[model samples]
Target chain A: MPAETTRAANRERLAARRAAEAAARAQAERRRRTVLGGVVAAVAVLVALVAVIVVQTHRTSTSANAAVPANTVDGTVISVGSADAPVTVDLYEDFQCPNCKAFEDASGRTVAQLVADGTVQAHYHGMAFLDTSANGRYSTRALNAAAVVVATAGPGAFQAFHDLLFANQPVEGGSGLTDAQLVQYATQAGAAGSSVEHDIRNLTYGDWVKTATDQASKDGVTATPTVFVDGHKLADLSSAGLTSAVTAAAAG
Target chain B: MRWNAATAGPWLGTAARLVLGGVFVVAGALKVPDPGAAVRAVRAYRLLPESLVAPVAFGLPVIEIAVGLALLLGVFVRTASIAAAVLLVVFLVGVGSAWARGLRIDCGCFGNGGEVTAGETAYPLEVLRDAALVVVALLLARWPASRLALGGRSVAGTTDRKEYSRAR
Candidate 1:
């Protein structure tokens, strides 16, 4: 009887130990799954946050680009000097570019003096690379419209519009000149009638602006204020360099 | 978990090792030439914050080289395979995000800056490719093509042959 009892006790002890081990393993597995689920949830939240940030940044960039005013210019292309001039200088520039404005402020007067004296013919074509986001309020549209006004209303309007654009080059990526502001500039430049208003609403000069940009690209111009004198490239568009190039081109 | 040379098929294991090794070597080589460009490319994705960009850009190539070498040499084959699989998963996620956003930028994977349309660059295809690699990596991790490896031989010699033979 005692032997049978001892055998039964041993069997019971083995069964209990097995049951305890199984429960321990089950608890461990549950803990592991919980930890893994928490980790996955955390990672998912992190990924979502990153996605939101990226989208917001892209949205801001696009909206900012879209906010700049459109152009409102009119006119026919005109030669800046007499046809008998020795050198022809073509300057492709964006008004919003500081460098372009600087080139104009520094070398513009000298070029004008030369042109007035019949030593050179300066043909200016305004390009619009910085029209997207660089010029906060003034876009390619506004610049192109201004070009049309200069073409129609004459050199006085072009020069006035040019000075105004340079003076109003917004702090990088900010809203550029509004449509109303552009009309004010045109009025100041002696542009008459509803021409500026008409061009702004109709986007009349968009094709011309695109063609000018394409021409600039074909000419191997990448940056702003690219000055080409009689098909010869100058290293810098500064007064000294431009004057020297024009003098050389005139002599050649 | 006794391992033996006889348990893993030599031909299959060697092929997997060569393929995985070639992939890493090619990827690493493509990125090694212009580290700065690679950094810029990653930044353009705008996935990683500015803070994490430098570290990831600098360390990624080195890790890829190490993983490639380890896979080719068959040293730490299992660990290397796991690491490669994890990297592929991360890459898939990034590519998937760009595709979802309708971005028309290059994958910049090989660092050539070749742009592709969002429609052309599908997230599922990238995920499928990575998944295929993951399968191969899992196989390598499980079977461990160690017959030709120095570590494999040492491990096989020390382990009980009878137990592994039965398990295989």
Candidate 2:
């Protein structure tokens, strides 16, 4: 009888020990989970706060730098209309941008009409956001070469080169324009001799391109085909909107 | 009964992380070249009130880069995966909304000037891709594949067995 009683006591002791271990484990797990939750919440809050600070900094910088004029930078000139026209429309474009091409195709004729009538003057600055990407085929080399062609060959050559580049934009994200292709486009634009080729090969006007791009950035211009009519930026560039902005600029 | 954890290897998780990270890196890099175009794309969404557009546009690429870096390094795997999944879903919704409204603007996923057609059909494909990513994320949330990660390898491996049993 004592042996059986001792056996029962041993079994109860084991049971109690096991229960205590299980409870301790459960408590530890709960503590771990609570600590993890707190850490995650703290990390999330930190990330959110950092994001807010960075955003505010960007906003402040952009607004602070917004006062710079778009056209004050000196660069290789690429003009589509008469230089002496009463109204000047400054265009910042990227060759890889479809909308810029669309704007050119859609409004090219109207713009030409206005230019020819001596009602408006359009100056284009080839910016290269698109060419930096795999999708930016023509905009890369063609834009650079066009700048040199304009610098070496003159405004007429620039206009002709611009038209050809737009007309012959390659498939998006394809291999960009080759040197031969650039020479071909430049030749078509009436640039002859080793001078134009040298200028392009040496990237002589590269500084001007960089300066133009930096100026655009300082002026808060972010997209291609950003048109500044006279000194005022247009709110939108839909066909009607552009026409109205141009008219207002001309009137002003 | 023995508990069976999902037997899929870590390759899928690794591949998903790499691909998603690559996509954001490229997207962010493209925008850094032309912030104005980025701002324009944000405006085209018309989702934010006008006041918020510039702020979101300027900072989104930086956020993308940070998330992409975290994902690629496999640090904070669960949190980064969840954030990435949520971001893709939001983008999918924005794309869908724009397409439905017949806006012929670019998706601007990569950057400004690389606009895709706003065809309504593309939205579904984008959403489907994001949904697949979310499933991958859930898997990561479960298995945590954190052996290769920076923050929680030991803890994850230890907890994984218990979680796997409980789940079963």
Best by DockQ: 2
> Candidate 1 chain A, which ten residues in sequence have the lowest lDDT sum?
A67-76
Q: What is the TM-score of chain B in candidate 2?
A: 0.75
lDDT of 2 by residue, A1-252 (tens): 999999999999999999999999987986797578548755774676467547544543433222221222354336666667878888877776666777778776667677788878887766665554464334546666876676567676777788777777665667766777788889988887797787666655554554455455445455566678897776577667778887877787
TM-score of each: 0.44, 0.55
The Cα error of candidate 2 at residue B64, in Å, is 5.6
Candidate lDDT (C-alpha), each: 0.63, 0.65
Off by over 4 Å in 1: A1-78, A133-137, B1-168
Interface RMSD of each: 14.2, 7.3
Residue by residue across B25-128, what tens digits does model 2's lDDT show? Answer: 77776776565567667777667876787667777777677667666776666776777777877887887887788644566787763234211235566667
DockQ of each: 0.03, 0.14
Best by TM-score: 2
Q: Could you tell me which residue pairs clash in candidate 2?
A: A135-A173, A222-B36, A222-B37, A223-B36, A223-B37
- Model 1, A1-252: lDDT tens per residue? 999999999999999999999999977986687567546644654564455445433432222222222222222233567779988887767666667767778888888788888998767665554444444325466666676566568665676677677766665466677777777777777775787677755666655554454445444444566677897766677788888888888788
After superposing candidate 2 on the true structure, give the runs of residues whose Cα lies further than 4 Å from its correct spot. A2-7, A26-78, A83-93, A96-114, A125-129, A132-137, A171-174, A187-199, A202-252, B1-104, B110-168
